[model samples]
Target chain A: MTTLSLAPNPALRSPPSALRNTLTLARRELRDAVRSRWFLLYTLAFTVLGLAVSFVSAAGTGGSGLSGFGRTTAGLVNLVLLVVPLMALSAGAASIASDRERGMLSYLFSQPMNPSELLLGKFLGLAAALLAAISLGLGSCALILAWKGLRTNPQSMFWLCGLAFMLALGMLSVGMLISTLARRASVAVGTGIFVWLMLVFVSDLALMAGAVALRLRIETLFAASLVNPLQVFKMWSLHAVDANLDVLGPAGLYAVEEYGALLHVMFAGCMVAWVVVPLLLASVVLSRRSPL
Target chain B: MNRLRLLAAVASLLACVPAQATQPDHAAPSADAPTTSTVPTTLGEIGRRVAAAEPGATLVIEPGVYHEHLRLTKPLTIRAGGKVIIDGGGSGDIVEITGPDVTFQGFTVRNTGIDLDKENAAIRVLAPRAVIKDNIVEDVLFGIDLREAPDSLISNNRIGGKALDIARRGDGLRLWRSDRTIVEDNVIHDGRDAILWYSKGVVVRRNTGLDSRYGLHLMFSDDVTITDNEFTRNSVGIYLMYSTGVEIAGNRLIQNRGPSGYGLGLKETDRFVVRGNLMVGNRSGIYIDGSPLAPDVPGEFSANTLAGNDVGITFLPSARGNLIYANNFIDNFNQIAVAGRGNLDANQFWKGDAGNFWSDYTGYDQNHDGVGDFVHESATLFEDLMDREPSLRLFLFSPAQQAVEFVGRAVPAVRPEPKFTDEVPLMRPVPVAALPASSSSTRMPLAAGGAILVLFGSGLLRLVRDPAGGPGGAL
Candidate 1:
């Protein structure tokens, strides 16, 4: 008789309210991002870099009328690899740490919002900003290609955009983790930059050094590269654009032979993990810590 | 009437020389036997007929698929009229010749056995003075195998292997212990290597190889000349291993991007001349490892164009006595990558006022002598660190590397010793005569594109400065 009654719980009915609060928080974060001039700086930098790469590639091809879309995308890939992660890290780390430093986080916590919802809202907002900036930058290149009547593979462009966004998300998650761990905004920013340098640049060097010192096979070098999210992104992005793994050097060829198209799926999975694991850790930390 | 007679006389004169040249080298022409005869259908029948044919007789074969292994003992000419296919049925050599002075022409040979130990080939010659011309060999383990077949000619043949992995495929054209051979004007692709092993005095000219392992691999083969050949998209364009007295000139090696990614790899080779060659779009244009074999011996590299490669040249610590001069080093990621604490200063970088042209050189030629007054040194602390730690390659051409370089320049104490220095660096690019015409033809488009890029960049810079000028004022 006691187990016979099954009714919708009042807490389960408040999903719409939770969704509305998340949207509102996301909107507020987006507004703050715009007000800080970070969005403008990102868009401007991307457009300029995109145009410059296209121009250089076109010129390098003997001005064959910008038909060298492959070269243009290739050049942009390196630029995106270097610059996007830094932008995402800085923007994402500042998003929470700056708010927390200004006592806004404490005020928000008092207003009936849970830590998960706040973190989710902030992540969604930061991710949206990053996507917008990337689209603008890459869109400028596409516009140039279209204006010049250049022959470009649309699928490649889509993949590039997707990979770049995923890369930004991964970097953002790392930044948010740092934001939650650090007590001060400056500390968070500093840690974010150092992490970017270590992951994006130093990790590859360290792997290569290890390989050389240990006399490891090229396969091991490729396997080691998978541990670094940026390396995974670079490999996946390059492989996606260019079917010829030979251009990736020895390690690239080995990866192609070992994983084939599965490498792309694996890299995507790693990127998702990169986004999820850090966010989960940050959420746990945020929930436990007392707001100042 | 007089002009027609004169033309006929000239034509006959030209035809007689080749006819005499095609005659068997050691055998006299048989007067009783017919000069030419058509072969019967089926592989067994052709082999029997060829054996029965007189020495120096020309056997003409009709177009058909002959699934059999053929062995010829008589010195004769085997000519196929049309699309004559000699398939090995996936076993043994397609055609094996033990007879001297045999000529093979105009046939499609394919599908030799996949036994590496047997060294199966579409066509194998064990005797001397054989000529294989104008034949198409496909889907074989080895396209053509010349074993102790001295003074042979392999020309105008299209040779390819099974479209398998490079390791599984055999050499397209292999010469073992063969001396004084000529391999010219042949198109080869998708094979392991066109190799010369223990072969002496080989001339490989005007051959084209693409999508293969090694375009031309010379190992323990001395006094070889490889000229006027083109290799594209191969593992290694031309690999010289433990070979000496090799002359590699006028060869176009382009875009040979593979696992090793070398256009040319020289190991333990000496007394070589590499001149007027074009090496472009490779990972490393030239990888020199322990070259110059002896203390007194030296290899000469001059008037070559090394452009658009990741590293123009990479030298191992043991490499010495190499003379590198008057080459165009254009648009390479790094001019040179030296392993260990190697000093390239001992190697010659200049011949008097003539030196290599580096695109990155910023020194001015104030005297208008076509050479910069300041020395061009290929030394950077960043590059040195990159050599020590290969992982630093991820930051190649990055602003951080550039910043460190700037600081290194400002502070002399941090500057590493120069790897190589050109006392007289060319202010302008190399002369048009020294460079390949293909490179020159591509330069115009690059120049035009660069100009447009500059204009677009400046315009974008302006737009960034004035948000109102940007499209939609979004920024």
Candidate 2:
């Protein structure tokens, strides 16, 4: 009896029970995120940026309330693209690595939970937190815009929020992958920042240089955009807000013609792949590594 | 010698018989009393009947597909009863008119030969004083080709082409050496250009050209007047190449944002007037390459509204003596982007006391006059750097660029050369007659909402700081 008790259990729990445990872990993580200072800072930053953009754009239209929501959204797209990715990356990069460094990951692993459950729980929890923070920030501004008697398109606003969420999720997955690969928490954080810089800023510049050097075609430029999840998000979000694809130059026009109705579906799929592939890689890397 | 005489006599007899048959024995149709002939099924039979009829006779063609090419060399009117199609069957010019004082109306002309070198057209007019109206021309190399057809009227025609790549398509309407022609109230789409080359005294009015390579392309066309037209979603709205004495007024050039996009591209053009035009949502509202080739005779641009463009007015460093005045520059990404880092002070930004209204201007109007108290100068070090290195354009709207701009504003010493300066900047935008009325209301409520948001943010901050509102307490 004593030997049997000490041995590993053979029978697995039902799917519902496993799902319950995952949800509980997710809720706990989410609760912790909401109370964190980083979440507050991100929310505040977004609100301030949104308001500033709206005000400036409104001033151009002779100060007619938030009638410039579309313009404001266009202006804030770059800012959100830069900052949200950084926030999501830092949050996710530090989650697993910091926990491992602090010996909390080991403690969590000792519980009646599988590795997949834990990884998925953390991802869902972090994604929810980021989404909540962004919604509050962007939502408040939109409400303010509405309160000012300006016409706002709910569809476009929802689409913008959705794109931002997907972008955050994509960055988080990448950060988690870095976390699993790195030996130390500091290394994970450093790598996370570098990756964010590369994806959000450096990649486009590099692509531009390559385009000039090779005299790249519009199709080639479009194909290159597929490799970067942030670019996909940017293109989709801008297309959603601005019906005129001309602002995106030649590549955008090609996308409208080639993809047409399936453009959104393709973008969403690319974002999902960005999340799934990185998480899968992180899982494989984590499983291979020995526990502290 | 006997056989040769017999052959010559036979040829003479054949020519005289045809001439006698074609003689107009029928009475000329009065303007009020039109003679309608609907029996001719083929274009060849219709042409024969038209030649046999009197000079002012009106022939009403019945609904049918006429596959034969037509040549009208008499002063007669051919009116279609219903849906009459003149199909060229991929042959040469579908309908060639050498007749003076002819009117061709209400026919669908299609499927002309696709030989750009041959300049095949659905309707080719070679004579003077012709009116081609209410015709639908489609899938042709050129829609309406008028060569040396002076004082002709081409109006109320719908011209379309196959949706091919821009380079493969031909001009919708081409007028070569055609003088004092009028092209009015027509719709041209999905073709190369509505071109006028070496044509003098041409007037293009109230036309809409969309999804074409170039909406209005003028090469060496002098004394042309283009007014009240809309050119939308084309590669280039109006391209003036080596044209002189051109006037473009009251036109709306919108959303022509293709590669090398421009609302108006002026290259080596002189003595042009661009006034009261609305250029919106283009890559560059007006791209001046080598306009005003001679500094003494500058192009005049006044009373125009350039809004929502990447760059309002871009000038090559060599372009000089262009007078820009009384225009509203609104919401452009870069107000003025010069190709080279040369001083643009020589180009006039103001006319005496009146200057263009810039939305980005921060100067105050203390005396309650419409003009701002201070001069408005546009151009910064960052923009100069961007001009010098085109690759830096990738970083447009980036935080680094914004930070640099902020720093440039904060520190005056680092400011770059002024691209242009207005001595008397307008406090209010010039009222553009062409633009639709804007629906912007008061912003007082937004200001209040902003205040409330600030308070809400601070409250949230307080909650975060409170010991009771910690992680355990919140859960």
Candidate 3:
């Protein structure tokens, strides 16, 4: 019985009561996130990205309305790939690992609350924070585009931001797993950054090289790539604009012709797996390691 | 081989065939009539009239529906009074011209049978010096089939084919062995192709072909000039096979994304020139295979904008002696690709000091010259790999592709020999048509929304000063 005693007992509470506790923790985590420097930095990075988009568009370079809009949005995809993952990874890795580093998680777990509840609560709160950050980022972008009197599509902007948010959610779950496993906060963060680099840079190259070397079937090669969250995000981002996937060349055409509508479902399933499976594994590991 | 019923049609006997009665000159149907013929009649009834009509005689028909197939056996003029409709009853050719110097105009010819083997058409011309203009041909298996008809002028015709599979649809405008023909201002859609087979000295301009199999398919057709034509949303735009002395200029070829999907494809052709053309959003902007088929007859491609294509200017091993300069290759997925195991070293990349502009060219021009200081190479390690294995293109939009290129560049040993290099690559894109600018009307709403979000963000930032500070230091 400690600071944990203030929280409800997990054993005696009904399902609804457990839900209430999870919401309470989620609300507290969200409030804390708002006050955190990480959130501030995350929001700043997105705002800077928005600024870059506007300035580039304002220069009157890309030309025409839709073409200019398309070109700028394509550029935004590359930047979002870098920032979204980094934000989600840092926020998630530090949330549990840093608190556990100070032995605060242990004190909180002194109550009858299950470790899974805390994990789920933190995830939901962090997801909400990232979404808010993304919205503000896109909002700033729209403002600048409109202010410069540049023609743009709101649906495309929303689509790109939505995809970025989904990427952040998936990366955040992986970060939580890293946080759960690594005992030290710095070590967890280091690991998270390394994982980010692997996902962002190394993994795709390796898969491409391996696929070529093995002469793997296109279906198999593409299926293997779906496991990587970044790859999934990249595929979806391209898919949104390119209806027939002509940009990806033969492979894109093959994807559309073969899977048709099922391709989206397959990608969506992989994204959900990235979000849910890692968080569940992290919670299981945390429960086992920090036994009540 | 169709039914031939010839009536002794005289110059003065207007609508004298069968039971058709002639109208008075003042009672002519249309105000746009070129001549003073007082006949509003059926083609089935006037088969004998057409056969017996004197050479160079003018025939005017009333503006009404005529469900009959007619054949022209004399050098006569058959013009519509107004909006004359000729329904072919879905069986045979609607109007077949077998004599030279026939002028057929101002008729809506439709409902040819879907019998490909029979080669049925709305109008089949087997004569020379024919003027076929100002007509609307729809539900046709074949629009206008000109066989051995030279010096013909076909213009201002809208030809729409039947709603059949692309393979089953007949050519919209088929010119076979017809020389020195001028085909212009025709809109042909939903057909197989507008083909010119062995038709030499042909000038095809101002034609628009949409949603067709091939826009203008030239097979063994020499000395052709195709200009100011737009062929979009088709299987292949303008394919020249075994043709020589051809000029393809000022054409807009967009989104020809069929299976082959080449905006402009040339195979075994020589002494060809392509300039001032807009090739955009195609699967491949220009695909060359065995071009410059002759030893010294080089193909010249200049001042064309090939943008937003999946693959631009693909070359086969047999393709050589091509002078490619002053073209803008921009925003393509894969700018240049070799179809098989070969390089494009045989082709000439530049003409003297002027070279083409590459959007991906990274060299800087320090002397303010339009030319890049360094040579531009199309080959990159990532692109090379992607060409070898098409599936590697899946990672093209991802950062991992850049990493591979970075690694390839870092290691000097792994740097590849580009398929072709431009020694005098243009630093700036040659200005084509200026881009249109549009002003956004959502400015006020967007600005207000941005202001609100900024305020919200500022409010959120103020919370960072809270004494709690939280566990963010670890982040």
Candidate 4:
């Protein structure tokens, strides 16, 4: 009852796959960053700052008293958390928005590839550059900590690196969204920062104002927290530190008890949303709009 | 004649005993230390002589401003006679008590300036069951700083000062890692934060804190119940962060007006009972901020009056599943605000559909009942456009706010609820603390339960260590 229709031999003449293009782009980006003065400057600045903070903290605790490799590593981890996303955002802003401004995007788009390949390739390139810089900086700090005979929790480093990756991806996605929406690179970067401030700081401030005004229960505060991914990230990070000390109240205990598994799922969901939503939206926009 | 002969015989026996066995030496030397005839010239000499005295001793001080840091490391009483004064003159702490069962009374202690760099205090009590009562501590950084002293009483002290001027100034009656202490009926006025960090089982009652940054600042502390206190003209009535199991009842938060001020600022706090508190004439009332990093802290808020504030209640992004029921939101500028779609599922709003009163409610009660006719869909136009363009928030207080509010209420849009509206909105205001009283403490359970999880993790590690059984079995 079914008619066999003859179609073009797609396997015989297929376009390049996304994974191969993405890797090639990533390699190109890595090479570009290695050749760039900006990348070198960023690495040098972070390294110097890391050393300074370590020295200050160590000196204050009394030099040659207690080796503070753990403390120094914590500081480095904190620095990575703060800096990696910022650098990712910068790279992301340039990925597409700057290429279009320079009129080099049209040529790339005209190549034998789809919009997904172009966008994915661009994202991969930025990620590769950021990861290299992050690993180098973190490794240097880690080496110093090891030399000082400090106990660094491998699990902590694992979680930290994983968190950094997620954050960097989220920031990059946000940047991509901005790049697609805005005509200029500056606007993309500014918008990304604006988003960061809102998620990290303003949301909590607004929630605080509400709780004070309504005199609501602790459950309400917990429910309100689910809307911000930064809170989820922070809660998970703190849980890693000390689960009991995460919240300073019994209400916190109840919330954690009530929504233990759900909280993790929700956090993962938000992280995915923060990444995929913006990137998907950007892709849709990029596909429609002129790359140049 | 018989009674007179008996008295004469007793007197003759007493004289014979002293003459035969040196009875006067034992009785006189022992009794002399308690009530010394000699006065000490120097502070060090006084300490040495006091140390040398017998137990249950009292070293009385004469009139002079003794500029010294006296340390009491033994169980003794230092009672001031007449006008005894010890002044550090902004150099260091006047007295540091580091002994059990020690008592300090009736001295004018002054000028305990906190070196942001040091643990400076007028008196630092580091003993259990110590009594620091009826002392006049003025112009000191901390009137009485207690450290890990349980069952101690710091009462009836007139502690006055220019509250710590530095950003690092802690509580005037600061308790650091202390437990089961009572700070009652004291005047802790004009301090940075009246009762600061790291204390448990503290009952801070009948206290007055005026002209301070925060009336009570509880940080990393638990099981503190502050009641019947008056906090006036302060930046915040109470700023509690990383504090748990705190019951703040029957307190008057009055006239704490300033830029960025609140009646109560609860952040990263859990398991609190905020009842019967009257927050009046503050910029904002009862601000709650969840740690954006750690959101699922359960909290309960009930029966608190928001008499006069710019905004009554606000819930930010990341506050969720909270129960905000049975509260009076009367005559505030704005009643409630929840997050927008930009901030989703961060908070839960319930009982809002039930008849919670709103000043801006234009809906008619067709049945002529006390309840409001319409559910307060409190989405404002300003919030929507602000989510799209946040830079426009600078004009929030401008005349445009009214226009925005008008437009927002007109549109029936859904926003996140603040979790405050009662499931059955009360016909009348419920009294704060009207519920059945329960005395629950916030001591964390023994680590035995957590130890099991550790063992499980260890077991996993052991399994991984055994390569023959672990990896091959899985493969």
Clashes of each: 4, 0, 1, 53
Q: Flag clash pairs in model 1.
A: A62-B445, A62-B446, A63-B445, A205-B391
Error of 3 at A96 (Å): 3.2
Docking quality (DockQ) for each candidate: 0.08, 0.16, 0.25, 0.02
Candidate 1 lDDT over residue span B1-475, tens digit each: 5553443333223211211222232122112211111222355867877868999999999989987778877789999989899888888678887789999999999888886655567888888999999999999988988888999999999998887876577789988778999999999999888888789999999999999978898878999999989999987899888898999998988788744667888878888999988888787789888788886867899888887676788887778888888888776667887865667866778887788887667688777998898999977777887666544454443344555677678899989888888888887656423234432233333333434433443443343235432222322
lDDT of 4 by residue, A58-77 (tens): 44222222232323433554
Question: Could you estimate the TM-score for every candidate?
Answer: 0.75, 0.79, 0.81, 0.46
- Sorted by TM-score (best first), the order is 3, 2, 1, 4
> How would you class the docking of model 1?
incorrect
Residue A258 in candidate 2, Cα distance off native in Å: 12
Error of 3 at B346 (Å): 2.6
Candidate 4 segments whose C-alpha is farther than 4 A from its true place: A1-292, B1-49, B58-64, B81-83, B162-164, B168-170, B257-260, B291-298, B338-373, B383-399, B409-423, B426-475
Report the number of backbone clashes for model 2. Answer: 0
Off by over 4 Å in 1: A1-36, A49-82, A96-122, A138-161, A178-228, A235-266, A282-292, B1-43, B163-168, B198-200, B242-244, B255-259, B294-298, B367-369, B389-411, B431-475
lDDT for position B352 in model 2:
86
Model with the higher DockQ, candidate 2 or 4: 2
Give a tens-digit lDDT track for model 1, residues A91-149.
87876787788887887788766988889888887777777677667766665655555
Q: List all candidate RMSDs to the true structure.
A: 13.4, 12.9, 12.0, 25.8
| lDDT, residue B4, candidate 1 | 38
Give the per-residue lDDT digits (tens) of candidate 2, residues B21-99: 2112111211111112212235575667676878888989999998877888788899899999988888677888878
